[model samples]
Target: MFYTTIFVIVPPFFLWRKKMKTEHLLEFVNVSMAFDDRQLFQNFNLTVDSNEVVGLTGQSGSGKSTLLRIAVDLVTPQSGEVYALDRPVKDWDPRELRRNVILVLQESQMFPNTVRDNLTWGLKIHGESIDDEALLKILEEVQLSSLDLDDDAFNLSGGEKQRIAIARAMMMNPKALLLDEPTAALDTESAIAVEEVLDELIKTHQIGILIVTHNVEQARRFTSRVVDIHAGSG
Candidate 1:
């Protein structure tokens, strides 16, 4: 008699982690970048690991935001390298790189569409889809559960917009998230609300987060490590 058998397989992460270095999710090695006629940073190095929150704090124009931009290939360094998930950022296509290492800037963009459309737009660009159940779950995770999917997304306050920006990044199932002063514009109450959502994200997920904040206290509050940018604030 012959016996029948089946094989089942499961992958832990979308990106291949076999060759990853000690759970490192994002890395900058000997990188150098500069603004017009003014050098911003040189020979800088940093890392963000899985299930970790790394903070960057410094005065304005200290190249903190520039580091976040370089991670996803938005701004390429004149020297050295930036890696995401063990692969050089230059090796990944721009859209694909941005998806894996999501960047949520201070003044996040809001489309004229509804909240549902704003949430799904990134996936649509990638030719992907998420059901209503999943969308609702992400909303709750970002502490915007009170928001209606069909509501005008442009009407949200600064804090709400920042959280939605994070939700938009979360929609991509990113391995790393880069935040440039995510709570800079919000009131104390608003900032705390956003931080609550971030605390939950850290508690429940294996992703890495790098936040740029002028407030060292805020950074210390949420991040596993806080890095102070020394580049002269231009």
Candidate 2:
């Protein structure tokens, strides 16, 4: 008689816990936001470790993207505090803070220039220099190794543009990435490609990701922990 052995696979959370660093890359304490009479978040608190993927989900106006913006200091809460790298968001230099906690929006904008130009634009502004070999390595990570540097950014599809934007942010070696609907604009194929890249990034680089996605299925697949603004309030 032959016996069958079945293996049970562990969830991503267990693996993530093993790899996570002690310190949180970002944190929100008693956060509250309102637009005039409308209240978005009240007494909201969350923390993102240095090596974890957190998914944010909610309805259309539930402050998912707004939360990410708060991390990067793009939007200030009416009350409460946000911290990055253990320092208060308001205390850090805006340019320096953005370098460490970069935000990549859904509709990523690309300069009407060569792909290489767009990739290096941030570095140029920050006065950082990298060789072609280093540059090409990052391109390969984003699955754009085959594209010519001279290729026009405007010619690429929406997915390609998003990937380029992500690659640009990666060049800064951020501690945490704030993604607002990263794959929302992509087709199935493109979305899958980007997802694969994100998986590798988390596994290899141990970069923390706070992603705001409306697709619950995608959130389940991508994140170890999911936070719903509405649910959390109750």
Candidate 3:
């Protein structure tokens, strides 16, 4: 009786482990998209695993930002499929999907309110109560722990505002973060600071990250693997 139970439990446990090992956090399979008369992408394929950071680099209008949007379901491909957490994107609830796969845009959009208000906005929208501890942790993770909760969010500098925006997304506890030129607008020092925070977040949270950057050096420094999009590629 004991041997039979052990065999049944151990076999299923190993199978589950194998399944997890084989699945990606986000995947795009043979994706194709076009805008107006321009074909931006054709049969593009990419995968992001939970343990690695992937960078997208290309010239302007190469569809790097569009790819990130597709991962978050903000944009639909003309053909092919996007998978998140081993399931098709269509199978996810939109709100839940956004929470799990947060996208941080290049420009920081702030509410005309206090930092506390902006931080809690997503939680309120998702019907979850604000946890002060979690909020503080996220702030620290994004290198903005010095700012008071009641401080005016719109009064910060461009780089500070960017950090705050990243903190807001981190508050949601996403499984993956899709960043569109996260450090593009910042000065050298500020950009380096933000990159440090991003590196720490990936290590500490064990979440996958896909970053789109026009700077080849930045892409090489920040990500484990880089994907270059071209005009004619299948």
Candidate 4:
């Protein structure tokens, strides 16, 4: 009887350890990156669970944006690994990975189309047409309630354009949002609007957010946790 109990308990314990070892929302151990001769980060490590917002801040040349790109698999690190959703980022299909972990950038580029079309572009590309109410709800979530449905996206202001870009990204309902300097070029009002929208999206959708910014004060307003990076020192 003693031997039987011992066999069962030990096997289960070992199996549980194995499963935990392979399970993580996102993880990077001893990650490093370089561009030409300049080192971006060395032995940098990060781990984030689902639905958590992570704020990253650093100096202009400290590679904060580059780190965001690396997290989403857009930029490969010279050495080290990136994992998303418990799998190596490189092992996942690019399209699938993108759908799962979407990146929102600072630059805004809109196709010459109606605001509706631009906002619903992601759904259309994914072989699904937008549900009118759903699209409108997303637009509203980003506080683009004033965006006329029939208006051309290209005619919008820079802040409007950025909001539209965010709407497009949200159309996929991704698990993680990796934002790279999203509010850098916007005015104070617009920047506040974007931050508010981001906060709402994360809370309502339960999506993890990682924002890379140079403004420490701005980061403090939105995220509960902040990671400050220094080049070559991780």
TM-score of each: 0.87, 0.87, 0.88, 0.86
- Output the TM-score of candidate 3: 0.88
Per-residue lDDT over 1-234 for candidate 3, one digit per residue giving the tens place of the 0 to 100 score? 999999989999998998788888898888888998898888888889886888887878878899888888888888988999988898899999999999988888998699988888888898888767877878888888898888999999888888888888888888998989988998878888888888898889888998888877787678898887653221
Candidate 3 deviant stretches above 4 angstroms: 1-19, 231-234
Clashes of 4: 0
Predicted candidate 1 versus true structure: per-residue lDDT over 1-234, tens digit per residue: 123222222254423455543656888888888877788777778878888888887667868888888888888887887888878999998998988888888788887688899899899998988898999999999988999999899999888888888888889888888988888888878888888888788677778899888876787678888876663221
Ranking by lDDT: 3, 2, 1, 4
lDDT of 2 by residue, 192-217 (tens): 78888888877777889989888877
Evaluate residue 206 in candidate 1 and report its C-alpha lDDT on the 0 to 100 scale. Answer: 78
Cα lDDT listed for each candidate: 0.82, 0.84, 0.85, 0.81
Clashing pairs in 1: none
Give the best candidate by TM-score: 3
TM-score, candidate number 1: 0.87
Counted clashes in each candidate structure: 0, 0, 0, 0
Tens-place lDDT digits, model 4, residues 1-234:
999999989998998888777665667767887899998778777776666777777777878878777877889988888898878899999888898888888877897689988877777777888667887898899998877788988888888888888888888988888888888899888888888888888788888888787776787787768877753221
Better of 1 and 3 by lDDT: 3
